[model samples]
Target: MRGFLASSIGVTCAAALALPLTLPTASHAAPSPTREAVPGSTQSLALDPLETSPGSTSTRAAGAPQEQGLTRRDVRPFSLVGVVWDDPDAQLHGNVQVRTRTTNTTRWSTWQDVETHNDDAPDLDTPERAAGGLHGATAPLWVGDSDGVEVRVKAEEPEAERAARPATLPKGLRLELVDPGEEPPQGSRAEGADTGVIPALDKKQTEDELIQARGGKSAAAGSRPFIGPRPRIITRKGWGANEKLRERKLGYTKTVKAAFIHHSASGNNYRCSQAPSVIRSIYRYHVKSSGWRDIGYNFLVDKCGNIYEGRAGGVAKPVMGAHTLGFNTNSTGIAVLGTFGSSKPRAAAVKAIARLTAWKLGLYGANPRGSTYLKSGGSNLYRKGKNVRLKVISGHRDGFATECPGRRLYNKLGSARSSSAHLQGR
Candidate 1:
């Protein structure tokens, strides 16, 4: 499935290491939704009238299996889209397809599938999950800049065994149109380049920054400590994140013991230069459309080997993220920015995963090639409080019963693990 969300009261709203980590103190700011203040905006539209299968005379009752969507219509210029519903626990058992017309041309693209199993979320019962206004959401889709869109969602039939009852579509479905907005102006921050990317750092330099960010503390002493050189990363500010869109207070965990890999499932039609825009779109979707506190992933790696900061918080800190559903407490999430169910992921992207995991996991003295146990908060795969053993670097499916990160990319985790461990000098 592909991933992609927007505005008028839309839906609301990942890491760490093991040194005697000096966790950042939690600070709160007044809750605010300054959507109009930012260049980017979301346009939330309620899904339109229901439709029946062609030639079928029967009408769909309020709770019956049904199809819902909007006719082709003009909308604010948006680069991404997704469908959301009122109940976060509701399952959308069906298909969601959309076609979009280019911003200025009469051209309309063929219908594309939006992944419906978006169960990859914060662990249940956590403060983030408890936050008000959460919703059931499909994976956001990156559709590029477009001014017109048409969408349809159809509920599938129940299997023969369960045929006694049909699947009913979720309630209050809404279409989220998101504009990532313009990229930040050149030279937006001292630490950022004109292209909005932060430069890579050598091992020593990274260690220094890591120490500085951690209140002048150093990692546990070792003659030959394992740590990888920091990869070049695009900061949230560099990518033009509207800080005001997310909740002011950042959440954190005690330590990061695992890294869950995911594919944004937002398709692979984007150019490398457009990645920042894609990140921004996903950020808005997660916050404005889905009602989460911030973007779900701790970090995002583009197909070109470029890494972008995901959820806000110091990159080196064990900032809590809303990535892996049941095991988010002690883990970080890294999403590669493209669908990889059948299409192979880029070599550069795979390498970036290795490089990033090596550095981030190493902070907690974790071996990417090793395994760790995380207690399940709750998920379809694991019961709440269950102790599950998983690799330090595992795919999204490892903790949740969903085909996330995608099959092609999930198959490459072994190689990424080996390379990451090697980079950490393990």
Candidate 2:
């Protein structure tokens, strides 16, 4: 096992040092030509200049410049949309809105806002952070099945002394249209009862699995630890994650000491049955469009309280994730599907958060209601190498200057922490 681990780490190091494997460069100077999403596949399309005027930059006010987006047009069928730019470090001080025409219908939805994720990213100097082709991106917005899209990005004016000047939009802005593709065929008499859902394990079964994961040897006398029952989880295969779309090597941390909660910020327009499709689309957007190693979160929950595995690593392992800027190490990220800025989070979803954290954090002997110190990798909130005290279960905004897991959701973390502790029997 040690040999295998060493070999895996070696591969991760080599891949990190290798060339930057970024998304294909696109020209954002003009309106992009129509593109198509291949059946059973995902696609990324760049937005062309929407301004009839010669420049990609337009003035919203005296000294305040704005960036134009693609003119409305028809394209291949897709179910999700987002915007990405050339530099991962650059911030888009702007507003992004998109409206799409439903497939085979004249009905065009109202323009919807895409949350600009200014700070959620991998730590500054890590291989994943420094990888070539990574881009600054907005939170992906799920748009269901559509063949037409229109987007607009307007820069907000700078604050204080710079109020007269318009904020600069990140360069190389492009539109990403993703088709989550078809759901995978269900398994017959497989691990998930042929329904794609991993059955929940009782307390004894979970302990046994934990023992097996720890080399199958019994613990020392009186050393058995308290643990929560393992909850049912939907597998990546169940969501039809195209393994080929992500990087071949998986990333890991030594241990998980914390869990960060987030909202997909992808809006609550989807049905519970469509949750798998939403996961697949975000997976594609994270890898194919955002140019990351994989989906940024370790686990995702639907509004119906169903848990779906995110990223490719084992669910029980401390898979390194990219969900929170400056604090991805030694922590897991749990994102509930949909925007919760104003919408109240569903009770089931919040309960699922507690249930997941109780079990996963219990495996590492962490008290979800307590606090721990983690060194910042560098963020707007903390400098690199600075150790900061954080709740064992925290919201995405706790570590970064962004509204994630949204307002209503963030407010619920206190109860989630208490419930998680209770589940762990602490």
Q: Number of the top candidate by TM-score?
A: 1
User: TM-score of model 2 relative to the true fold?
Assistant: 0.85
Q: Candidate 1, 170: how far from true, in Å?
A: 0.2
What is the clash tally of candidate 1?
20
lDDT of 1 by residue, 237-299 (tens): 677888878888778777889999999989998998899899999999999888899999999
Against the true structure, whose lDDT is highest?
A: 1
lDDT values, one for every candidate = 0.81, 0.77
List the RMSD of every prediction in angstroms. Answer: 6.9, 8.4
User: What digit string (tens of lDDT, one per residue) describes model 2 on residues 70-119?
Assistant: 87889889999999989888878768999999999998999999998645
What would the TM-scores of all predictions be?
0.88, 0.85
**Alpha carbon deviation, residue 277, candidate 1 (Å):** 0.8
